[model samples]
Target: MTTPPFPAPTTAELAVVSAQLGRTARGVVGIAARCECGNPTVVATTPRLPDGTPFPTFYYLTHPAATAAMSTLEATQVMPELSALLAEDDGVAAAYLAAHEAYLADRAQFGEVSEIDGISAGGMPSRVKCLHALAGHALAAGPGVNPIGDAALERSTWSPEKCRCDDPGAALRDVEASTA
Candidate 1:
């Protein structure tokens, strides 16, 4: 199995992630990225789940705010816009290919599975499918790793530099409302 770049998940981290996702955290191998308040923002999951299911998404966005921001962008028809860029910009296509390679390398750490081989999320190297997945990879890999993800993040209302979770009470209320 591949080792996650981030630290192993603490029980408390998993709890926070479950709260963030409004579901039990499954196959989470590491906390890929954290909010300014030190809560999980992105989680690195196993390539293959415990049930032997091949899950291609290695980096998953966990923070409600980040997910919401990506959703909003998606609703604005950002996917096609970005997909057009991918079609027209050779540099972007190359970078996206590199991102896809990076994703494959990262997942290879978990062990190579035929079912998910050469498949990277967010329609890498060709199209933009899921901004959340792209953003998750950006957050996990850091800036400059995934260009589309970086672009989406740059256009987002949220920023890692900002401490949006400074107020736990507010964050909890928002999370509760989202889960509800």
Candidate 2:
């Protein structure tokens, strides 16, 4: 049996993530990866949301700068280039397929969602679809797990090594304390 990626998110973390996404995060199971400054960079979302929606993208990227960088890459014709590389490179294709399996395995640890049982994000196992999803997976699973995600991160300008959050830790803490 596969283990869940995390226990649960703190209220502060959920608040920060909600702020990052500009919406109350629905299925967040845990903070999958964090920035150098401790803010969430990637979130581990459950396969099924609290409201019963089937959420396929397990590792959801939340950092604004990181998401923007992936968006920039997606906007700049990088998908086709990566798709071409995925087509030509046997190693990459194989690794990408493995990554897809890993993704499904991770989500399966939480619960089975029949709607997304075989679905992994970023058009995984076959084609490149969303850089944000791929990058999120790379950040959560780390390097060498997802070749396409690693490639996307390498092509993008965002770095998890730095903090680009508008307010970072203090604001999130302050808000939580106020609510408490």
The top-ranked prediction according to TM-score is 2
For model 2, residues 1-180, the per-residue Cα lDDT tens digits are: 655666689888899899889999888889999887788899999888899989999999999999999999989999999999999999999999999999988888889988887999999999999999999999999999999999999988988887777766665677678779
> Candidate 2 has what TM-score?
0.94
For candidate 2, the C-alpha RMSD (Å) to the true structure equals 1.4
Residue 112's lDDT within candidate 2 is 91
Please identify model 1 stretches exceeding 4 Å from their true place.
Answer: 1-3, 166-180
lDDT of 2: 0.90
* Pairs that clash in candidate 1: 2-109, 2-110
* C-alpha RMSD for every candidate: 4.5, 1.4
Per-residue lDDT of model 1, residues 40-88, tens digit only: 8999888898899999999999888899899999999888888888899
